[model samples]
Target chain A: MAKISMIVNGNPVNANVDPRTLLVQFLRENLRLTGTHVGCDTSQCGACVVHLDGRAVKSCTTLAVMADGHEVKTIEGLAADGAPLHPMQEAFREHHGLQCGFCTPGMIMTAVDLVHRKGHELSDEVIREELEGNLCRCTGYQNIVASIAAGAKAMAKSDLA
Target chain B: MYEFKYHRPGTVRQAANLLVKNEDAKLIAGGHTLVPVMKQRLASPPHLVDLSHIEGLDTIEMKGRSLVIGATAKHAEVANSAVVGEAIPALAELAGLIGDPAVRHRGTIGGSLANNDPTADYPAAVLALGATIVTNKRRLKAEEYFQGLFSTALEADEIITKVMFPVPKKAAYVKFRNQASRYALVGVFVAKRPSDVRVAVTGAGSDGVFRVTAFEDALKKRFSHKVLDGIAVSADGLNSDLHGSAEYRAHLIGVLTRRAVEAANAKD
Candidate 1:
């Protein structure tokens, strides 16, 4: 077993985990943070997407030990308590960005990171390009990109307000 | 994935020692490719030595006329690196063009090259740039490195420390990407290094990435698209998949090579 410490959802969490435990497995199984879903078990699916030190990464491909000392933000930590859904989540809901909720959390997490990095000016082409790794079989991706753009504008407005 | 002992060695030397000491060990950098294979039960090793914590393996530095990219440098780092953009813009574009943003954040150049998937993008860049693969033991030229499909000259436990790509006069990567997975269906890298021109094609050939000698010679003489019109590459030894036939890949190699050259020569 490997003793690992890292900032998880803005809280410092430590645990004794098998060295071979994947970050997705550790988060979903051990920590009981089942908000992050497992889609393909391969990195190809974005169902296990999360923020590692503020950047999007497929948690399924990352080992728990590799995440030690780093900050991890799973889908569970996206919105603050008593606060409305994070702008991205709200946008997804408004835009009907989901058919099944299986890929929603991961898509929102990845979209949030994309908007944070690329900002609101991103074109549909750019969004599609950025989302090449993330597979969304349900929405056809138009709504997903729209949701991201809407979320970006909302986040910007919130900041200005 | 089958259960295995995992070691996250903080230092490169420690990681190398662990790999060497273990009889059935594989180095896992980003795990973007390895983990997937492991999960499929395609590759099962007794130990996996994770190399993420090692310091100095994530750097991108300029050395003389070349760019020195640390082995563990992520695709995102390379795509956003000013050094890579200024020195070799094609490399930056290629890095940006790799499998989506999530894969870019976690995938490493070393892991990609070491994995050497036949359809991978980095092989074309490394071969076209005439780069050097600097290992713990020795440096290998790109021509001497790639042997065949899913094959490389690297011995077990010989950890790659850095990849050195000399600044080419001009370079560009044009890929016919697989629509869903985004793996290159047929990708070509065109580069002019000093007076010499190199054309390397990936995804198309059964031999993996290889230079187009005919295109290289023509480009060497004229260095333009018209010069490549007369050249004909045989369909033999090219890859055929559901995406394309061998002939289609052969044809694409020519088309992408020309486009890449034109893109390279286009004004910034």
Candidate 2:
């Protein structure tokens, strides 16, 4: 067993992880931070997407040891004050972005990263391009793109304020 | 993923030493491909050497007329690099068009080339640009480097520290990308070096990425897409999956090659 320490969800997290422990496994099985869902063991599905040092990455492909010195933000980290939803989360709720909610957390996280990178000036083509890794069978991408577009605008307004 | 001793070596020498000690030890650069395959039980190494912590293995240097790219350099870094854009814009564009933003941030050129998945984009670019595969032990020319599917001339302990791409006069990559995996169904890389013209095709053949002598011969005669009007690619040893048939892939190769030539010519 290897003892690994990382800044997870803005808090210092320490755990004993097996050498084969993936980041998604560590987050879900070890720490009980089950917000990041594992859909496919392969990197094709973006259901395990999370922010590694503010960049979106599929956690299943990332070993837990690789996150030893990095900062990770799962879906659990997006909320604040233990009450309110993040603007993206709120936008998803308002725009009817999710259906089954199996891939929502990863989709939201990836969108958040995109909004942070591309800002409110994102086009549909740009959003589609950024979402190449993420797959959502339920939403069919229409409402998800709508949610991200609205969320980007809302995020931009919040930043200005 | 299968259980294995994970070693995060601080230097390439340490990683190489680990590899030398254990033949079963596999180098994990980006984990974009290897880890997933491990989870599927397709590949399981007794020892896994992680290369992320190794310093100086990610530098991009312009030495003389060649752009030397560290093997561990991320796809995103190459796509955004000013030097790569100035020296070889097609390379930057190819890097940018890889999987997605997330994959680009994690996938390394070294990892991609070493894996040599037949459908991968980098192999076509490397072969067409006449790049040298710089391993710790030897420098291999493009023709002498790639042996077969998911195989290379790299030795067990040999680590590819860098790749040297000669500054091309013009080049372009055109690919018919697979929708789900984002891998190329059929891709072509066309480059104009000082002396000769090179055309490399990937994702269409069982031999993996290879230069097209017919296309090169035609392009040498006339450096235009019209030169490739009558060239016929035999589907003798091509890959045929659900995405496309061997004949379909061969057809796409000609189409993409013409498009790549046209794209490169647009720049010149």
Tell me how candidate 1 scores on lDDT.
Answer: 0.89
B218 in model 1: Cα distance from truth in Å? 0.5
| Clash list (residue pairs), candidate 1 | none
Clashes of each: 0, 0
| Tens digits of lDDT, candidate 1, B1-268 | 7888888888888988998899889998888898888878899899999888889998999999889999999999999999999999999999998888999999999999998889999999999999999999899999999988888999987899999999999999998988766789999999998979999999988888999999998899877898988688889999887888999998999899989989998935
Per-model TM against the reference: 0.97, 0.97
Poorest lDDT segment (10 consecutive residues) of candidate 2 chain A: A152-161
Give me the displacement of residue A70 in model 1, in angstroms.
1.0
For B119-153, candidate 2 gives per-residue lDDT tens digits of 89999999999999998888999889999899999
Give the TM-score between model 1's chain B and the true chain B: 0.98
Best candidate (score: DockQ): 1
True contacts kept of each: 0.82, 0.68
Worst 10-residue stretch by lDDT in candidate 2 chain B? B175-184
DockQ of every predicted complex: 0.79, 0.74
